[model samples]
Target: MTGIDETFAGRKGQASATPGAANVPPAATGARPSETRGVHPDAVAAIMAATHGDPFAVLGPHEVGPGVWEVRAVLPEAKSATLLTGGKRIPFERRHPEGFFVARVETQGRPLYELAVEDWDGSERTRHDPYGFGPSLEQHDIDALREVGSNVTYRILGAQAKAVDGIQGFRFAVWAPNARRVSVVGDFNAWDGRRHPMRLWQNGGVWELFIPGLKAGAHYKFELRGPDGSLLPLKADPVAFAAQKPPETASVLQGTSTPAWHDEKWMATRGEKDPRHVPISIYEVHLGSWARVAEEGNRYLTYKELADRLIPYVKEMGFTHIEMLPITEFPFDGSWGYQPVSLFAPTSRFGTPDDFAAFVDAAHEAGIGIMLDWVPGHFPLDAHGLGQFDGTHLYEHADPRQGFHQDWGTYIYNFGRTEVSTFLAANARFWLEHYHLDGLRVDAVASMLYLDYSRRQGEWIPNRYGGNENLDAIEFLRKTNEATYTHAPGTLTVAEESTSWPGVSHPTYTGGLGFGFKWNMGWMHDTLNFVSKETIHRRYHHHDLTFGLLYAFSENFVLPLSHDEVVHGKGSLLGKMPGDRWQKFANLRAYFGFMWGHPGKKLLFMGGEFGQEKEWNHNQSLDWHLLDDAHHRGVKDLVRDLNHLYLNVPALHARDTEAAGFQWLVADDQDNSVIAWARKGREAGEVAVVVSNFTPVVREGYRIGVPEAGFYREAINSDAERYGGSNVGNMGGVRAEAVPSHGQSHSITLTIPPLATTIFVRED
Candidate 1:
């Protein structure tokens, strides 16, 4: 074996760079363009010999001596030198072609020779080739690896059966190869694992312990000690079914997570699956305050109570889907369900896992789909739970460089670990299988896709030359999407990604992140900003509303007024309007109409459709009293009609059909702030033209284009006096021009109301 060695002459003479040293010519600079500097002939010969004429190859970096190292890795097509690490090879789905570098390594000593590799472009990075050397097998490195890898002896030895099945009165076992003593601590034993020292069975380096009298639903953790009398802290079972509060013990819930569908026969009644026509109106609600603890008490709204009270309310609202905030068990009450502790457990605050399943089933019976908010990118820093799970690094990396996240103040899972991956991927499948939920809305996905997502330099590790391609996280996300789709092909998974991470909603096979739809955060921000501006300002940025339409075709999109926009001083959607209360209501109605009119799926927060005046407070009930007001009543009516129009309009729901069948018949932002558009469909008389005016002045004869040349009638108007606005809408029908112009469009001069939206349809 070759050992790294340095001589006094070599180190003291050529290695030391003089403080004022300038460029000095060597014997031969012929390898100029490639090396950029003179390299020793022997060094060149050694590299070429090591890689066998593969001039592009470089030995990847490895720990050689104290603060020294040699780099060895084949940079087949890299643009620069790459960091390398020890990790299992996994197939990755590629979205855009980019070079992937392994993690950086910090070594002890200087190496005898240094190797550098470079490539012109990212064309050479592929799974079919190797780019770097395996991890160094130095003693310290091996010890570190063994420390992390050995912590989960139960993973390989199969004591995880206890975590899956639970251990009281049941056979529970785990193997800790490095531990001399093992104890099972869990809810079954009142969390006292020491009273019952687990029987230690050793087979080679594998150490096993089996405990009896544990039952499913029993929360469990392990207590281990090495031969050196070093005690390992309590550790959660890797495959727990249930988990203890916030940061401690994992729960081993009884029975399978799968539930038998009570409406199996009902599911077969659907003729053809059309997402557009499937009554897909989603009512986004927060469970904590949908109903409160007064009648339900601090005891909380059980899944049964929500089914009893909420199903009718949702069905009455004409919503066909219910999108819940993150229901996973979270510790902080103030968080709008973002800080999740347990990946598998539905928030116990809402009820048990089975209860959540019943709620989903109840909704299914009521002809509604349920979508859960899933947060997997970051986890809370809970010492009792996932953090330091096995005394040593188990689920996460030991090195602070690999484990911590500064932005979230939480520990991100080492997605590169196979078991960690399986845990996450299985959680995604578990929700779908157990609850029969139709979809999931993945939260904070931008954090999961990038290494430098929210990190500042010196706080985070970098690739060799200090680039920020988070290869592991990217691979994890890819695998997660693929596995989720594989498990349930039609199940919808939406991404709440803010960054322009390409193909987040693309299929997994194509190297995309594989989500069904991405929340149109861009549209939400731009539209909110534009609408909040004065009428004149809207004209200048009218294109802001239309900008998303360009790349919107690449992925399915959902325009959402999510919880983020409602809380923390952002204010409610109605509160964001630029005019009076009436104008505010009208503007909101117009915006919703426009949102539905745009080519995307739509979601309204719990209080949005009804015009709740107050911002969303997670702890309290929505201002249901607002519905009693005459002003808010019109908003509710408009929302109901919007849902009806969405259901009726074929142009709205045709798969992947967005603004293509639409045209801006009129957009004179100055003319009383009126704008109009039409949606065309094959059904001859099914077209609808929408006209809106922001000014209080009613126009007696505002000419707007119609798709057909015939008698046009007002279908719905937001300004009816009984509902709310100034009651300035035209009471009678307006006849269209005899001949059509501008692509079969007919202009009609009719009375239009200010601060109101009107839909005029052709009379058949």
Candidate 2:
């Protein structure tokens, strides 16, 4: 006789010889085995067709029972197995409710393959086939699908339209084929997404539970285990209506039936101002660092406290807008909100969802527009959410080419899927619709639109001719832009794309990416380099500063000194200057004036307004004490003044919308500097002359053209002592004398100060 293992393992111990056979009679043998018996050969053929024979080869048709059979296979070799199976394999591609079957096969403790069983009727393939955010499956892959287990389960119930009182309850269901029992435990049940032990319904295939008290704002997740007490993947519920943070378990949220809103009057009363005319003088602030707990006090700032303390200051400074960094729920404490796990849930770390809504409402009431920094390119690999969700393919794809992002060490969403697109689209709408935000500034767009982005040669695939354009991603972006604009006509959407993609800011109907504006990264880079250099050196680099104009028309732009440039290894803008404190102030002042004068909207980080001396650190508060320094205080005043002018000047506000608003009066890169023009509201002969002498020495007799023969007055000067300037040349009353032009127009003669930008207005 064979060894015990050998005797029972081959073909379900079919005896390899019928017991009666030679031992008794042909009558004892079952009627000729049914042709429909054992594994269906067509099913095996389908598996071969899908994977191209990548994982395993079918070995048998041996019958083990009346309806069951033992099918064997030569598993795909171990190293090659990972490519087809392992953690990255297609999951839930095949699942059924009749028999509740999912099959996954393993070799030597490592998943070598999987196969799913189909039902007698055709309902199995039609109903359980994976799509969108659901998992993918392979043939004969039951055991493996049973291995990873379920992250969340939901039941759909049709409630009679009349049954809804003040609160409505939902029927919840979970599918855990491997679990012996399950429970709903969450905040409603006091930290139990797995309590009120769901009743095992309909042949024990599904565990179902219902809570009469569930409603929006409730947080939750589920806990499940096997008969022998082995724990399965107890993950955060995927469809959780809402969620909270650490030390507290997630609860099932009841979606809001009626969101409290008082903004209809506000929306109706506001006029339809052109977005280009909207004066976007953004003040960027980090909520955590803007204020903090004293060593002797609490460690957090309530949303209300921040609104009372900060909103008034911003409104008083004349800022038209406020842009906040990411507020998504994240696990890491010190990050700049780059790491995000939950797509639908807000960070419980800040304040409750209602509190966040109130903060935005308060800002709107104060007439300050709000822009949120949205990070959708990638997500943190936190196990509690997104990662390995629902036993497979939740937020990512099975193939690394479609799944992993090399640069961020995070999972990129499979934008190609309908459910994934819906998830993100809903998220965008959630903020705009539910929270009443004015706009969104999408973060890290470069990563989202490129396939080869941050990948090594062997790691990524290119088009047939070897190019980097991610066609699917591009299509997805096109759809996203169209849907967003269609949903909210007036809300702004800005892309932080660093690459040279064309038409990023154009309208979608025009075959463009359809963002309302792009960050103007090229301008930011060139301007920073030019201003930080010595004025003399700037003369040689003047062309670099103006190079941005070639592509400036591709989209609207915003010149931003955002958190990315200041917080990382890159030094603070103030620290980059090669001069003393006074010279440093001069450089910064000139830069700000130049930035303001440029044909784009403006943004300054919180501390930059008051001249923060230290680099940004998320763990510590902004250097608030630095405001005491005279130089620092001067910069603050300058920013406020700039804001005042930005709001009041037609020349500035008008620039926001029309290309004709800005005109260059000079382009002399040889002289190390140049001058430009800005006009307002088609007013004839009404213009603003912006002149900068990047040279170290003052240019005494520099002459530029004017529209008319009137004298010009200095509207704002970077050399003013009150604004951290050296007070050089006292431009307070310097008038540019008008000289007759060779043509019908006229000209002006003025002394342009070194390291200063002067905005001249024609005296009426």
lDDT of each: 0.60, 0.59
Tens digits of per-residue lDDT, candidate 1, 1-764, equal: 11211211132321221111111112222233321222334333333222111111112233333443333332324565432223322222211123223222334443222223344754433221111211111222212222321222223322333331232233334434444455556664455433333432222222233333334566666666544546666755444445554433465544343554675643454324645334367889899887676654544577889999888888776776899998877768777677776665677676666777788888888877788999877676655456655455556666666677676677777877755665566677767755667788998888776667776776677755576766676666677677666655556788999988888887777878878788889989987887888765666776666567677666778888888889889898899988767678878877776776666788888888888888888878878777779878778887887777767666555533455556767654553566777766646665667776655678787777677777777776777765576777667567888555445556788787766677776676
lDDT of 2 by residue, 506-581 (tens): 8877877778888988888887887778766776787777787766655888888987778777777788665778
The TM-scores, one per candidate, come to 0.72, 0.73
Clashes of 2: 35
- TM-score, prediction 2: 0.73
